[model samples]
Target: MQVDADFRPILGPQLVRLDPMRIKQLQDPLVYSSIDSLAKLSAHCLNLRAPLTTCEKLINSDNTLYLAWKFDEEQNVSRLLGFAKVGRKQLFLYDSQMQTYEGEILCLLDFYVHFSAQRQGVGKQLIDYLLAQEHAEPYQLALDNPSVTLLGFMSQKFGMSKPVWQNTNFVVFDELFQSFAAENGEKAPDGWNRPQTPRRIGAVSTDTRWLRNAVSGHQSKGNAMAAPVDADMTPQGALSNRAHQAKARKAHILSSKPLW
Candidate 1:
């Protein structure tokens, strides 16, 4: 939708990554208001019962909203064409053949182009940019409760047909299920989207407190007992797996050369 004020001075003519930390630091009133309106527009276009996105929810979660902006000379302002919200989701996925598996996937949560920009390739532009940045293909993606329109779009654009059913709202296509089966018990790499158990509310994080204290020239007391994770909130063995994966990710980062 076209706004009265120009966002060109703010977002520029590029695909922008809108994350919690960036928005929190920028502190722009127009940015928040514009994004909120766009999200409502998205919900309306998709016939959702309620607005699926808001600044309040954005700041509280790990999801990223990617926006494609276009300068509308007729309106004398910059218009944001659409946005794609994505994040890592842990799910129990089921294939058509009844094979079940647990995996973490990059999920397409919500996607919509503004009514004014629909059918004008704005959606494709946003998707192309997202796929490039994520280093992912359409088949590798999971969709969260996609509308029929979106499902048709996937079929047309990426040849993605029937999806594997999920226990939750999310769904992955047959290609992903086939890939998992073909892997033959081999595990996916740490950086390639794996479930990381999030620390529970009351659980103290077993962080590198000793290292930090030592760097600050503070002497630590004798060893303190580690707090147990709340099993009620945590899946069994997930904590240990997450720890191991975290270490593996760290090692991979240190060993890999800089992409930039």
Candidate 2:
């Protein structure tokens, strides 16, 4: 299922459903070790901030199936927004083989927007697109973001009901959901599509504080907590991993003496 291309731009980025054809775009080793690992990290952070847990797992023991959404633009091929998905096992655990009595359970497992894209409509658009999918059950959406106000706005505007209080975050429900119209009161700004705007993301918003604090605190705390992770260098582990790899390659070339 897909929305019209015209509407896609207004949504800031188009939400492309994850399938074998499109999965490669979502698997960015730079941002995530595996798409599976990215989902787990997204879950962990959302849980830490919202303090809720639904016991969702992004990767199965066998590592067989995966699902996700990748947001992208028409003009800029290199520029991308973020991706989200649900592992098959996570769906099973959450509903016991899809026996959800309440509503259709769609878990937002992994979500990331380029820092440049935060607070833009990327997330909202993704959620909106998900809601518009074909479901055999009622519309139940679960995510652990600590966006009480935005979630509340979404609940009201998109017909989602109140979110259930979980340990780490809230799981919201909606019987009838649709793509957000610009007229919707909870519409997110199109700042993401705009370039060269100096916007302080978390300043006026409640959602920003937690992320800003988490990142700031993580950086200030230094590499001690992250040293172990630093050892296993995945393509996506470090901010400068690509550059470091390039430099190492250059150094190797310089140090090695060539024989004629």
Candidate 3:
């Protein structure tokens, strides 16, 4: 993503973290425009009707976007290589053992690497940076409507082979449940199978993104991995999108799972 003006002075030649407060403090239109443009492009790449990420959502939500930059000395221009947006969200999550809980969990919102940079480890670098910052393992995180490509990435990079499907766009891995069980007693406490029954390991500041989108049609009832339905990455279903209400159009579901 190229901007008219050089951003090396503002962003430098390193990965930059952008959040509501950081963006506000900078008050730079170029930064906003560049971010918005990259989001639009990412949405387009994911075959979405609208951009999943927007300036308004970032301002209102507790999302953090990490921007990977590339500075061309000859061109004297700084361009965005990729970005990964993540945040802590309170969600009704189902674990691998069919247990349900409500808590503020870290989520991978959006990830994108430019076409020119794909397969060059840029995407991995971005995700690694996110994990390092959050001090989290890949299996312990929830994915918002992950696309097929993203699913493949997880399978290949982190061996997250099993994903516990939820009614909403979010999905969790079996290891998360194992981790929770190991941390809180030997297994999920009795009555944890019911919706929002058990408490998570701990609490954190959670964003209200799901609650805000509850009224929308995209938050359809039932398991997202079930067959004959549209794709899974509805909210932030793809590597490029996250947290926004997915389009109503029917297309392909990346993969299906049992109606748990």
TM-score of each candidate structure, all chains considered together: 0.68, 0.36, 0.69
Model 2, 190-217: lDDT tens digits are: 4322221222222221211110001121
Where does candidate 3 stray beyond 4 Å? 187-260
lDDT of 3 by residue, 1-260 (tens): 66556787787656777778876776778778888888888999889998878777898888998889877777777677888889987687655544445566789888788777789888888888888888889986788888889888888888998887788888788877666656665433443332322222323222211211122122236534322433543334553343232331222233343323
- In what order do the candidates fall by TM-score, top score first? 3, 1, 2
Tell me the lDDT of model 1 at 144: 91
- Candidate 2 global lDDT: 0.38
Instruction: Looking at model 2, report the run of 10 residues with the lowest lDDT sum.
Output: 205-214
The alpha-carbon deviation from the true structure for residue 250 of candidate 1, after best TM-score superposition, in angstroms, is: 50
Compared with the true structure, all predictions reach lDDT values of 0.71, 0.38, 0.70
In model 1, residue pairs whose N, Cα or C atoms come closer than 3 Å (at least 3 residues apart or on different chains), thus clashing, are none
Clashes, model 3: 6
Ranking by lDDT: 1, 3, 2
